[model samples]
Target: MLAALVLLLLTFALLLWPVAVTGGIASSLSYCLSALVPSLFPFMVLCGFAVESSAALWLSRPLGFCARYLFRLPDCCAAPVLMGLIGGYPAGARGTSLLLEKGRITEKEARRMLMFCVNPGLAFTVTYLGIGVFGSPALGLRLFLSVTLSAVVLGVLSGLFSPLPSPDKPGAERMESRPGALTRSVEGAARSVLLMCAFLLLFSGLSALLHEAGIFQGAVRLLSRLGVFTPNQWAAMLSFLLEVTGGTGDARALGIGPGFFAFGLAFGGVCVHLQVLAMFRKPPIRPPLFLLCRLAHGLLSAGAFALMGVISPMENASTAPVMAGIYRPELSGGWRGGASLALMCAAFLLMVPGETGKSSLRAPGPKLISVAGVKFPLQNR
Candidate 1:
């Protein structure tokens, strides 16, 4: 808590320094709010509710079964891991935390789950990268396949390396059957979505403030000159470190051939890494393992993208304009930005409170359940 507080304070102090010294407070504030409000607001509201009630629930059972049988993880962790893949990092982390608190999963299992749980989804790939940024669904498809396949391979490998405790292990306990699976699932999903939305909004605002103050540009320039990256590559790198949306936007702005852009996008930016790190907090996972997994993913993604760049056929000229058109940002009149902010605020309010009133629903009433013909105590409501 203290560390988080200090970080927040430092962030604010940095943002305020320029305004305090130059007396550009109003302009800085305006730029910060405007830049953040449009993209961050609606995303919080729409994605927040949709992710919890719809995506998280839909994926949980299948994910649980896979984790239990394939990975040998405790039954409790399946839903969260699945949620992580479908709902993204925040959702996954939140789900893991909830499961941990409920005593459904041990710390070791939670940490292991975190290793493979931090990633965006196919929808994000198709919508944001393919249609929104790349202007070609085909490019998006290839990039999505590359990233997804890499994640799957890495996830499986990590699971193999980090073997779960066997049932005979000293601390191994039998799984409990929960009664309000439906309700708990809904509550858990909602909480996960709300938390993610909050992070997105807060970070988006921070990102906007930095961008408006020209800090982002300076950082990009510094990073670009440090290595083999070109100016545009530097931008993409910085954006990835800062935010996925920003990184993807930078990649689109490069105006490079689809092949180069695809590589950059696949390699991902720093922001994705940071988001993954942020998700680790809830599970209290070991930082080294998480970092190692990300490093592996990065290397693999870079390799895949590079190969695609070399072998993929050039996009047709006729499609270029269409792609460009899709990637172009529309300049919204002032009113639209304000409307977006309003919508975001509304969404935040709607999703943040749904968990407060719900009672802690216990698992199905205490009864021994058999797994692999071995019976164990069950804690039920």
Candidate 2:
């Protein structure tokens, strides 16, 4: 306890020092506030509720047989699997941990599912990469398909080949009975999101420290001397190695090819890996699995995109309009980003006691969100 308090004190001291003024801290804070806080918080809440409320277990019932045979996983894992595909990295980790806590799935199954479910979402692939970066929806779609296919291949192969291990704790295997399941789940999700934000900030500061120390510069100089890559390629590669999100942005700025962009996207860099590793703290899942799967996913995605480039050359999308000025209702307000954002915001706003904002949301038990003439109710049971 003393050590933990000391560590916390040291963390605050560093943030107070040169880190906050640096661009790294600024960028990380900007990302969390503008994008991650609003975007991820809602999904995190929903995911938490999904597992605690038996929503995942209820949904996975019908698909049990297929999931068992095809994926070599118990039907109970279907929730996390689906969440992982849609939610991306750490969603699977979140789900796995949840299921493990519930005793619905063993630690081995959860670990296997972790490798299986993690992937970038359609929004990141299509909206950010496709339209925002490459300026071509087609290129983004191609990258998305490639990454999905690669993840599927890995999951299937691992399912077939790997043998199961005993649960981490033999007796504590299903969800335990507890009061305030809804509140607990929501709080759990909130905690997870906050933790992720912390990791991002820490990584950003560390990256800035490394940069100021000339570590990245030295790496670029050494790599350049190898004569293996051009200046632009080296820049893109270096940025990609340092921070996944910023690296991809740099790679795109350098005019790196679609295949390489896909590679960086799939690789998700060390920043993302740290975010994921942070999620698995309670369960004691292996950290190395996340790293291994990412490398494999990156290689497979890059190869696929490269092959596609050779077969059907991407048109010069340089002239394509940037995504910022466009109205992409499909990408934004659609399932991937928009709807969930609304629901999450509603959940959060309505959570404040006696502050439902209006008479319509002032229900005693739960809240309801009406969209397109349909009512979706949020409740504990």
lDDT to native, each model: 0.52, 0.67
Model 2: number of backbone collisions: 5
Encode model 2's per-residue lDDT on 212-310: one tens digit a residue: 444555666667777787655665676665566667655655566676777777787777777776776554556676678888888988888778778
TM-score of every candidate relative to the true structure: 0.59, 0.72
lDDT of 1 at 2: 100
lDDT of 1 by residue, 1-381 (tens): 999997997577666754432333343334335543333333333333333333434444455457755666764455556556655445555666655665656777777666666655556666555776556677777766666566666667657855553332322222233344556555544544444444554455565556545576677566655667665556555556555554454455444444444443443344444544454346366656666766566567666765765797646422122334333244354777678778978866665536556234333343333322333332110
Clash tally, candidates in order: 11, 5
RMSD of 1: 18.8
TM-score of model 2 vs. true structure: 0.72
Cα deviation at 157, candidate 1, in Å, is: 2.6
Q: Which ten residues in a row have the lowest lDDT in candidate 2?
A: 372-381
